[model samples]
Target: MRHIERQIVQLKEKILRVGTLVEEAISKSITALINRDSALAQRVMASDEEIDRMEVEVEEECLKILALYQPVAADLRLVVAALKINNDLERIGDLAKNIAKRVAQLAGEGPIDLPAEIRTMATLAQEMVRQSLDAVVNGDTALARQVREEDDAVDDARQRVRRMVLQGIKVEPERVECLLRVNSVSKHIERIADMATNIAEDVIYMVEGDIVRHRSSDY
Candidate 1:
């Protein structure tokens, strides 16, 4: 392979590494929240540094490629996507960490009924993140578009969670603090879904040279 091509390949690998770390963090945070596993939540929080470091590494490599090769066309798009996706993945990692923090707070609270919608929302958000990364790996704009479409389901689920939490707060004022934490977790998961959608849009841009951001689904 040519030198620039090789660097681009490495760049993808590095970005995917960050994705893997962020995915694991998200999964662990959700598990910790549902199980009330403070130890596991701490583990997720601890790994944020690694994810942040990997993101920086990917960004540096992309800048290096851009400076050395001055890549244009598809190569430029790939590097640009890598840069944006790296930031998104890092933000996802931070959101997962925030969820872990909420889990830690709830771990000591009185027993509270967890909402089913929260689980559904978490599942959809995680799937979106996974599929978005897959789209990046395969350069599959179809998969990327599907990821974009799935964001709506997550948003709806998040709203349901918020309503359920609000009702719970009204019914059992004693559990208000815990329910608020649960709502915060749901919001974090929703933000993670948004970041995943951003990554998916970046993938579409990388592959089709189409800037689909801020556009309707018709794009």
Candidate 2:
């Protein structure tokens, strides 16, 4: 590989490293919340700082490649995709942190059974993040599209959670506060899924050079 290509490869690797950290954070955050483990929640919260640092480093590397390489064609697409994916990963990290914060707040409260839908939502979002990163690493647009398709499942799960929460609130008004927090968690998971979809779209653009934003129907 040429010098520029090597730099691009390094940048890609760094992004994937950051991606892995974010994915782990998401999984651990959900586990902490469901298990009501304050220590695990605190650990996830602490890891967010590292995730933010990685995001900054990845962005800097992309900028360095852009300035030094002046790449064209697919190389240019890859660099741009790296920049976008880096942002998406950072946002996902924040979502995980938000979930951890909720977990910390609910730590002392009585354990409320998690709605089944929340688990489904969290799982689908986590899968989307994993598949999207794999798609980028492998330059597989088909896998990217599959990640996009999985976002719908997350959405459906979120809607189900919303309905369940609303019903819980109606039946037990005193639990409104706890139910609201659970709803927020569901929303956070949905946003995580959205960010994963964005990353998958970036991967598709990098591979095919075709923009899929605002045109999910075609995919």
Please count the clashing residue pairs in each candidate, in the order shown.
Answer: 0, 0
lDDT by residue (tens digit), candidate 2, 1-219: 799978987888899899899999999999999899889999998999999999889988988888888889999999999989999999999999999999978876688979978888999899999999999999998999888888888888898999999999999999888899999999999999999999999998999999997896346
CA lDDT scores, all candidates in order = 0.91, 0.91
Candidate 2: Cα lDDT at 113: 79
Superposed model 2: Cα runs more than 4 Å off: none
lDDT of 2: 0.91
lDDT of 1: 0.91
Q: Rate residue 53 of model 1 by lDDT.
A: 83
Candidate 1, 1-219: lDDT as tens digits: 999988887888888888888999999999998889999999999999999888888888989999999999999999999999999999999999999998878878867678988889889999999999999999999999999899999989888988989888898898888988989989999999999999999999999999999998667
Clash pairs (backbone) in predicted model 1: none
Give me candidate 1's TM-score against the actual structure. 0.98
State residue 25's C-alpha deviation in candidate 2, in Å.
0.2
lDDT, model 1, position 176: 85
